[model samples]
Target: MKCVVSGGNIKILARAIQMLSKIGEEMFVQPQEDSLSFRSVNGSNSSFADITFHENYFSYYAYEDLDESDSLKCKILIRSALTVFKIPSLINKQIETCHIQLDANSTNLCFILKYKNNIIKTHLLPILDCETIRANYKKEGTVNHLCIQPRVLNDVVQNFQQNLLEITIEVLKDKILLRNYIDETSNLSNETRTQLVFGMGEFDEYKINSNTTITFCLKELRAILHFAEILAQPIHIHFDCAGRPIVFICKTLGVESNLVLATLNPDDDLGSQSTTHTRPNSVLKNSAKKPTKAKGKIKSLSKTVFGKLANKYPTNTNTEKIESSDKISNASETSSPNNNNKFNATNSPRVNSAKVIASNSNTNKRENDNSSKQNAFSSLLKRKSNQEIHSPDGGDKDDLVQNSPPKQPSKKAKLIFKKCFQTTFNPESLPGYNNIEVEDSGESD
Candidate 1:
C-alpha cells in the first residue's frame, strides 16, 4: 500500500494528526479500495475520532497487491506519527510533501518527507499487533442541533481556564449556556467559575426538540474545534439528553471528520437531585426483602413443631391421677390386719418396738424389703395423729382406706406381676422381723 500527501494538503493532514494525538495514544490505519481510514479512541474509551481521506484527497494512491475483499489493517504509535508532523506551521513552510507506504509482509511503516532544500527525511515506525478500535453511536434524530461557526465557539471556550477538564452545556429553546463543570465532592472555595450565554440569533442554524443539559470532556472538544477553525467550516452538533454521546461533524473538499464524545448526567452522581432517582432505592428494596422471607419461614416452622407436640401429649391427665389414687387405697385396706394391729396400739409396747427398730437400723446398713415395709407402716401411724391425709376425690384418706373391702387382683394385674414373684424363696417367710418378741398390750381386761 502507498499514498502521497501533496504540498497543499500537508498542513491539513498534520493538523488532523495533531488532533488525533490529543485524543489517543495509538492510531489504527486501514487501507480500503476507496479511501484510507485513521481511527483513534481515548484511554477511557469515552471519546472516538474517525478521519477518512478519499482518493481525491491524496496525490497518489495505490494498493493493487492485495485483493479488494481482504482487509489490511495496522496499528502504529501516535507519538511516532507525531514525530513526522511535529509542528504544523513548520511542516507547512519547510516540508513540500509526505510519502507513506507499507509492504504486505513488512513490519515497519515508511514515512518519507521532502524538504524545500532538496533534503529528504525518512522514519521507519514498527507496526504493533492490536485489536481494531471502533465506536457505535447514532448521529440522526437527536433532540438538539446547533450549526455554529468555529470562531464563535472557540471564542467562548477561550474564556474558560486552560487547566479545566470538563464543561457543561445547556441547550434551551431560546438560548445556550456554557459553564465550567465542578464536581460536588470538590471544595468550591478554591475554584474559579465562568459562564457564557448565547442567544438563538448567534447560531447560523438552530433547532431543538426539547431542552437538555450535558457535561463532557473539554480536551476533545477543543481538538475538534481547532480542526474546524483550521478548515474554515461550520461545525454541526447533534445531541440528545444527558448521559448520551454527542456528535460533531466537519466537512472539507474531500475529507470528512466525525467525533463522538460521552456525556455525564448530573442525576447519576452519589448525592445529586431526585430526577429519575429510582435505581439506588430499588437496590435497597431488593436487599431488604430477603431477611423478611427467612423470618417468616422460621415462625412457620416453630408453629408446626408446637402443634405436633400438643397432639402427641393428650389433655386427659386428671383421669390418670384418680385411677392411681384408687389403686393405692385398695392396697392399703388389703394389707394384713395383724400388722396394722401391732402398729395401731398406743401403749409402751409400741414405744419399745420403735426402739428395737432404731437399734436394728443402726446395726445393719442393708436390709430386706420386709424391714423397709415395716418402717413405712410405722411412720404412717405416727404421722396420723398430727396431719389428716386428703384423697384426690376430697374424701378423708384414712376413713376411705379403712372402710374399703379387700379385693383380689385382676387377671391383668396377676399376669403383669407373675414374673416378679416367680422365685422359690418367699420374702415373708424369712424370720428377721417375725421373730421379734413383743410385750403384752396394756388394755384393761
Candidate 2:
C-alpha cells in the first residue's frame, strides 16, 4: 500500500497519531481495498479509540493490487510513529508529499517524506504480529444526548478545581451540571466540593430520552482534550448510564476522531448510611480561611530613633555609618597633636592630644575635607620629588626623600552625640535652653 499527504493535512494526521498514542502505547495499522484504519485499547480496557481515512481523504489513493476482502495489518511502536511527524512546521510549509509503504513479507514498514530543495527523509519501523482489536459496545439505547461547541464546554470545565479524581455529569430539566465526584465513602461534605453548572442555552442542541447522570475519570477525558485543534468544531456526546463508557466524536472537514471514556461505578449505600453523622472539625475546616504568606517584605533604610524627641534619621547619616562601621576604634586614629594641627592648619597646634569626634553633618564634612587636602598635598610632594630624582643632575634627591612626613593614620567616623538642645537660646547662652540644666547656687547673706 502507498499514498501521499501534504499541506495542513500532514499536521492533521500527525496530531491524530499523537493523540491516539496517549490512549495506548502501540497502534494497529490496517490498509484495505478502499481506506486505511487505526485502532487501540488502553491497558486497563477502560477506554478505546478508532479512526479511519477513506480513499477520498488522501490526494492520491491506490490499493488496486489487493482484493476488496484482503486486509494488510501491522503493529508499530507509538514513539516511532510520533518522531517522524514531530516537526509540525515542516508539515504546513515546504513539504511536498509523504509516501508510505507497508511490507507484507518483510518485518518493517518504510515511510519516505519528500520536501522542497530536494530534501528527503526515510525511516523504517519494526512491525509486531499483534491481533487487531474489535471492541463490542452498544450505542442504540443511549438516553442522554448533548451537542456542544468545543470552546464553550472547555470554558466551563476549566473552572473546576484541579484536584478532583473524577467528574460527574448530571442532566436535568433545562440545565446541566459538571462537578467533582467526591467519593461518598470519604466522608467529605458537599460544601467543600466544587461544581460547575450551566443552562441548556449553552449547548447548540440538548436532548434526553430519560433523566440520567454519569461519572467518569477526569484524567482520561483530559487526555482526549489535547485535541482541542479539532474542537473548533462541535463535539457530539452520548451515554447510557453509570459504569458504561461515554462516546465522544469530533469530525472536521477532512477527518474524524472517536474516543470512548469509561465511567466509574458509584459506591453503594455509602451516602445513605452517613446522613445522620456529622464531623464537627470538618465543618470548621471547611469554613476556615486558607493562610497565605507574603512573597517579600519591603525594607526602608531610614530608622526612627527615640531620644528626648521622636525623630527620623537622615539617609546620608545612615550611608556613612554603614560604610565606616567596620573600622571605628580609638586605634584607627592617631592622638598626635602635631598631626591634628597639620590637619587643622588654621587652628593652633599643642603638645596635648586632639580627641574631638565628628558628631554632626557639618563637622563630618569639614573633617573629611581636611583629610582629603592633607592626602593630596602628600601625593603632590612625592610626585615632585620623583621628578627631581629623574632630573639630569638629580640634585637634593636624598634631602627630599628624608623630609617627607610619615603617612597619616586612617580616618575614623563616629555617630555619637555629645549634647542635644532645642528651642531658642539667648545670646548669653542660658542654662535653661541646654539639655544639661545648671543648678543655681546663692551665697547666704
Candidate 3:
C-alpha cells in the first residue's frame, strides 16, 4: 500500500532520533527516497514499496528488498524521529501511546500506524497487517498519508520556545521566594530611618546593599535584590534595632548611606561626653554614692560640749560658774543687822506722826478720789449738756413730761369766770369808740 509523510527534514529527523536515543530508544536510518517506484524483492516473494514524502524534500520508502529485520529497524527509526521532532505538537495533542506494524511479501510491503485511545505508543515495526493493508489498497491506492508543513513545524518550535519562557518566569519567581525565605530566617528586626547618638565619632552600621567588600550568600543577595526590585527605593541601615549611633559622622549632617565600615572603638572619646561641662570621673563617682555632710563630726562635737556648759549656768554662760554657798553668803551680807538698825533709827516716827501721815495720806487719797469722782460726774454732765445743746426744739416738751408733776383740772376756773362776768353781751357801741373816731377826724381836718 502507498503512504505519504510530508514536511520532515532529514537533518531535523536525525537530530530527533539522536535525542530519542538519550531517552532510551534504539533507531536505525534508511536511505533517502528518489524518483524510483520501488518494489519489494524478497528471495522468493515480491511486494510493492510503501513510499512517502514530507513537505521538505523528505521521503520514506520501505520495501522487501531488505530483510524483515532491516524493515522493522527502518520503521523504528522513522517513528522515533517523528516523536522527537513533534514533541511539542504531541504534548499539545495529548497523545501518549503509538504502535507501528509492517508486512512484506515478495511483491509488496505493507505498514500500519495505529493509535491506541488517541495515545502515541512505542514498538519495533514490520509486523504484518494483511487484512488492513488489503482494505486500504482496495479503497484508495494509498493508506494513512500524514503531512507536515513548514508552518506547522514552526508552530511546534514556537510552542517549545514559549514553554521555555514560562520556565524562566517560574525560576525568577522561585528566586523571589528564596529571597523572602532568607529574610525571614535572618530574624533581623526592622531598621528605622533615623539614628540617635550620645557621643561623637563615626558610626558603625551594616551595609545592606552597597558594600562591595561584604560578600553575601545566595540567600542574602537574593533578598537584597528582591528588596530593591519590589520597593524601588533605597533602604537605610542603622547600628542596631535601637538605631543609636556608635559614633557621630563628622561630615554632612543627616546624609545616610548604606556603606559601612568598622565599629567605633570605645576609647575614641571625641569629647561629646563633655557637653555638660562636667568632669566625667567626678560625675560618675558622685552618681555612684549617697551624699553626706562634710562637717557632720565638727557640728556634733560643738553641740555636745557647748550645750552642756550653757545648761549649767542660769544665763547660759559658757565661761563663768558660781557655787550655791557663795551666792547665799553675798545675799546675807547685803541684809546685815547694822544696816537695818541705821535704817530704822533714821526713819523713827514723831508724836502723832502716824496720824498726821495717815491723815495727809487719807486727805490726799480723798482729794484724789473726789477729783476722780468729780471728773466722772463732769464727764456724765458734759454728756447730758451735749445732748441738751444738740437736741431739737421739741426736746423741752419731752423734758417737761419727764420732770413736771401731772395736775388735775380745777372746778374753781368755772366759778371764777361766773363771778367776774357781769353779763355775756356783745358791745355793739362803745362810749369812746365813736368819739375817738370823730376827734381823730376833726384833728385831721
Candidate 4:
C-alpha cells in the first residue's frame, strides 16, 4: 500500500519500528504449514480477519493476510504512532468503531468514535495522510507502507499547514496585547480624556480642542504605531475632550472593546480645583508698617513728657526736704491742701522785727518753741496719769494716752477743773451752797 505520513507521525513510526526489531524471533515467528493445518490456522486467520476488519477496511486488509511477525509489526507501528499523537488506538480497533467526518469543502474533519452508549465527534484538521490510507496502500503495495498514510495525502497536508499559520498569528496578537497591558507606565489621571492626552504628551501626541476632545493627528498616529511596534504589544487608545467621552480607536484592530469611556464629573472637577486662599507676605508687610509708625509716635510723646517733668523737678535742687516738712505740718492741721494753704497765708507775725530784732526774735522763737514743746509733753504725761486713775475703761485710756504726745499745762488744767466741777455740784450740793450764801449776805446787810 502507498502511504504518506506527517512529519510528527513519521517520527513516531520510526521509533516503533526500532522497538519491534529488538524483540526475539520466537515470539513473532510464523507457524509451519503442517502445524498450521492441525491448529486450524485458516480458522484463526478468518477469526482475526472478522475481528480486525470490522472497523476500517484499510486496517483489515492490511493485517488479514500478514504472518504472525508482520501482524505484530503492523500493530506495534500503529500503536506507537497513535500513542505519540495522543490518540487512543485500543478503542478504535473495533469494527466500524471510528470514522472521519469531513465537511463538503474537506477543510475540517471530525473523528467519530463510540464510547458506552454515546457517539463522540472530535474536530480535527484533515491534513494528515493517514486519513487516505486506501490510496497509499494501492500505490505502495507493501503492508509496511500502510503503517502511516497508505497513499498520497497532499490535500489534507496543505490544509493543515495553512491552518497552523492562522492560529499562530492569532496567538501572537493576543500575547502582544497582554504585554502592552502589563508594561504600561503612563499614570494618566482620570480627568477628561482631553486632559489626559495633554498630560501624557511624552507618551502620546494629540491635538486638544476647546470642547476638550482630543483628536490624534496623522503624526500622532504614526508615533503610536511606532510605539506599538517597539513594545510589540497592543494597547487600548481612548480620546476625551473637555468633559465628554468619545469613541476610542484601537490601533491593531479598528474595533473597540466593550469598555465605557471616562467622563469628567462637574462637581468633582470643581471641587478638585478649589483651594483655600493664602494671604501674601505683602499683607503682613502692610500690617507691620502700621505698628512701627504707632511705636515711633508713642516713643516721641513719652520722651517729650519725661523731659518736661525732669526740668520742672530738677534733681540738682535741695528744696525737696524743706517743702516736704512744710507740707507735712500743714496737712496735719487741715482737712485738705487748699485749707492748709489758706491757714498759713492768713497767719501774721505779732510784731515786725527789722534786722537786729529779726535775728534775735528768730533765736528767741526757736528757744521758746522748744521749751513749750517739752512742757506740753510733761503736762500731757501728767494728764494721762490722772485720767488712767479716774476713767472706768482705764486700760484702753492708758493705751491711747501712751500713743499720744503730751498736751500743754493750760489744756490739762482746764480738763481737770471741768471734771472736778461736774462731780462736786449736784442738786443737793447746790441747796447747801445757796444757804451758806444767804447767811453770809444777812450778816453783810
Candidate 5:
C-alpha cells in the first residue's frame, strides 16, 4: 500500500497524527480502495479515535494488493509516526511531498519526505502485527446533538482550570451547561466547583429530544477541540445519558475524524460520599440533615451489652422446676371433692421456704438410697438396646443421620452419658494412665 500526501495537505495529516498520539501509544494503519483509516484506542480502553482520509486527501494513492484476501494491515508506534511530522509549521515550506509505503512482506513502514532544494528525509519504522481496532457505536439517532464552531467552544473551555480532568454537560430545552465534574471520591472541601451556562441560541445548530447530563474526560475533548480549530470546521456532538459513550464528529474537505469517550455513571458511586453531587438538590438538603452511622453504632452497642448481661445472670433453673411442680400439685388439690377453701395457702405469692427445702432434701435422700452404679449402667445399656431395635439398621440412632466414618454423637446421647460412671471408672486402670501415674509417684518418692 502506497500513498502520497501533497505538501499542501501535510500539515492537516500531521495534525491528525499529533492528535491521535495524545490518546494512545500505537496507531493501526489500514488501507482500502477508497480511503485509508488510522485508529487508536487509549490505554484504559475507555476512549477510541478513528480518522479516515479519502483518496482525494492524497495527491496520489495506489494499492495493487487490494484484490488479495489478506491486505496489508499493521500497527506502528505513535512516537515514530509523530517524528515524521514533528513540526507541522515547517512542513509547508520545507517539504514538497510525503510518501508512505508498506509492502506485504516488508517488516518496516517506510516514509519518504521530499524536501525543498533537492533535500530528502527517509524514516523506516518497524511494524508490529495487530488486528484491526474497531469500536461498535451508533453515532446517529441520538437524542442530544449540538453543532457549533470549534473556536467558540474552545473559548468556553478556556475559562475552565487547565488541570481539570473531567467536565459535565447538562442538556436542557432552552440552554446547555458545561461545568467541571468534581468526583465524589475527591475531597470536595478542597476542590473548587465551576459551571458555565450557554443558551441554545449560542450554538449554530442545537437539537434536544430529552434533557440529560453527561460527564466525560476533558483531556480528549480538549485535544479534539484544538484539532477541529486547526481544521476550521464545526464539531458535531451526539450523546445519550450518562454511562454511555459520546461521539464527536469533525468533517472538512477530505478528512473525517470520530472520537468516542465513555461517560461517568452516578450510580457507580451511590453508596459513597460522592452521591450528594448526583442527587437532586432537595435530596441533598435532606441528606445533610440526617444523622450518620453513630445512631446505628449506639443501637448495636446497647444490644450487645444487654445480650452479655443476660448471658452472665442466667435465670434460676432450680426455682423454675420447683414452681412448675407446685402448680401441678395445686391443680390436683383443687380438683379433689374434699377441697372446701376458695383460696389456698400455696396460691399466695409468698411461700414457706423451709417446707420447700425440707421436701427437696427428702426427695434427694430417697433418690440416693435407690440408685447404684450397676443400676445406672444397666439402664444405659437397656436404652441403647431399645434404640437399636427401633432403628432400621440395628445401629445407634445417630448412625441414621450419618453413615460416614467418624460420625457425630447425638445431643441426647451426650446428655444421658454425662457423669454416669465417672466415679466408678479408675483412670489408673488404663495402661497409659497407670504408666504416667507410676512415674509421677516414683519421682515424688
Candidate 6:
C-alpha cells in the first residue's frame, strides 16, 4: 500500500505526532481511501490521542486493498516518527512531498521524502505489531461542556506553578477557575497556591449542568494546548467529574482534521472538593498575584510557515528507477535526479546535497560506500530538519529526542546539516539533481 503526503499535510501530521508523542511511545497507523489516522495511548492509559488527515490533505492519494488485507495497519515507535518530522521548517520550505509505502512482505516501513531540488531521500522505519487505542467514554453522562479559545486556556494554564502536578478546573455559572490542584496529601499554603479566573467572555460557552470541578495533569494539558495553539483553534472540552477521563476536541474550520485527546481524571479522592457554589469569593487566598496571563515565547521551526508554498516532485521515473531492497541490492544509479511528483522546488534555494551527506556520515572515510552518499543525504535530511526545532512548550528540544539529548552531530555534520537548513529562496530548480555525479569512495561498497 502507498500514500502520499504533501509538505503542508506533513506539517499537520508532524504537529499531531508531536502532541501525541507527549503521551505515548507507540503510534498506530490506519490508512483508508478517504483519510489516514494516527493514534496513541499513554502507558498508564491515562491519556489517548487520535489525529486524522483526509484525502485532500495530500496532493496525491492512492490506496489498494487486497481481500486478505482490507486496510493498512502498522505501529511504529513514536520516537522514530518524531525524529523524522522534527523540523516543520524543512517540510514547509525544503521538502515537497512525503511518500509512505507499506509492503506486507517486508518488515521495514518506507518513507520517500521528495524535496524542492528534485532530490529524494528514502527512510526505512522499523515497526511494531498492529495496535489501536480505543476510547470507551460515555457521552450522555458528561455534565460539563466548555468551549474556550486555545490561547485563553493556554494563558490560564501558563500561570500555574511549574512544580504543581495538576490544575483544578471549576465550571460555574459565570466563569471558569483554574487553580493549583490541592489533594488530601497536598498543602493549603497560601504561598504555594495559584489561581486564575476567566469570565464567560473568555470562552465561547461554559455550560454546566452542575457546578462541577475536576483536576487534570498540568503538563499534559499544556501539551494539548500547544496543539490547539498551533492550529489556532477553539478547544471543546467534555467531562463528567474526576473519575472518568476528560475529552478535548479541537478542529480547524478550514482544515481537514478530527483531533481528539483524552486524559483520565485523578482518583475520586480529589473529586470531593469544596463545591464552587459554597466556596467563598475565591478558591485560593494566595499572596501571589492572581495568576497573570502571560504569553510565553514560542520557538520557531524554520520561520517557514507550514502550507502549500511550492510545487511537487516525484520519486523516480522509468529511466532512474529506485530499486527496492529485495532486488538488485548492489546496483547504483548514475547520480541522476528523477522528477515525477506534483510539487517542485523550482523557487527554493539549492544546496550541495552530496557534500551535506558526507558530513552527516558516521562511517569512516575509508569505508564510504556508494550508498554512503545516499545515507548521508537521507540522514542529513532528518538531522538538519531537527535543528533549532522547539518542543510544544516553547522549550528547545534536543536534536532528535523528546526528553534526552541526541549525540551532537560532528562539527562537519552540523555544517552539513546547516547548509541545507539555513537557506532562504527566490526558488530555483536543481537542474542536475537527478543525474548526480558521485565521487568514488569503499568498505561498505
Using lDDT, give the best candidate's number: 5
User: In candidate 5, what residue range of length 10 has the lowest lDDT sum?
Assistant: 353-362
Per-candidate RMSD, Å: 40.1, 35.4, 62.2, 57.2, 31.5, 26.4
lDDT of 1 by residue, 1-445 (tens): 8999977688888888888998889987767665777778776556778777888889999876755323356778989998988877888788888998877756888889999999899989888843344444455567888888989989989999998877878788999878776544344346675668889887888998888777778999999899888788888898876655788988787677778776653332211111221233433323222222222222222233223222322221111221122232244334534222211211112121112110112111111212476684565555455343323342222212121122456978898777567787465765684665886778856
Query: Per-residue lDDT for 318 in model 4?
Result: 15
Between candidates 2 and 4, name the one with more favorable TM-score.
2
What are the Cα lDDT values of the candidates? 0.62, 0.53, 0.23, 0.23, 0.64, 0.53
lDDT of 6 by residue, 349-380 (tens): 21211121112112121122223566656655
Using all chains and alpha carbons, the TM-scores for the candidates as numbered come to 0.59, 0.56, 0.13, 0.15, 0.62, 0.57
Compose the digit string of candidate 4's lDDT tens values, residues 222-289.
22222233223343333332122222122222111111121221211110111111232333323322
TM-score head-to-head 1 vs 5, winner: 5
Candidate 4's C-alpha lDDT?
0.23
Measured on C-alpha atoms, candidate 5 has an lDDT of 0.64
Candidate 3, residue 140: how far the Cα is off, in Å: 31
Instruction: Give the candidate number with the greatest TM-score.
Output: 5
Candidate 2 clashing pairs? none
lDDT of 2 by residue, 219-285 (tens): 6566556564553667778776654558777766556566766654332111111121123333222
Off by over 4 Å in 4: 1-201, 211-243, 253-258, 262-264, 271-445
Q: CA shift at 98, candidate 3, in angstroms?
A: 24
Query: Which residue ranges in model 2 land beyond 4 Å of their true spot?
Result: 67-71, 139-141, 161-165, 183-192, 267-445
For all candidates, what are the clash counts? 0, 0, 23, 27, 1, 23
> Which of 4 and 5 is ahead in TM-score?
5
User: Model 1, residue 177: displacement in angstroms?
Assistant: 0.4
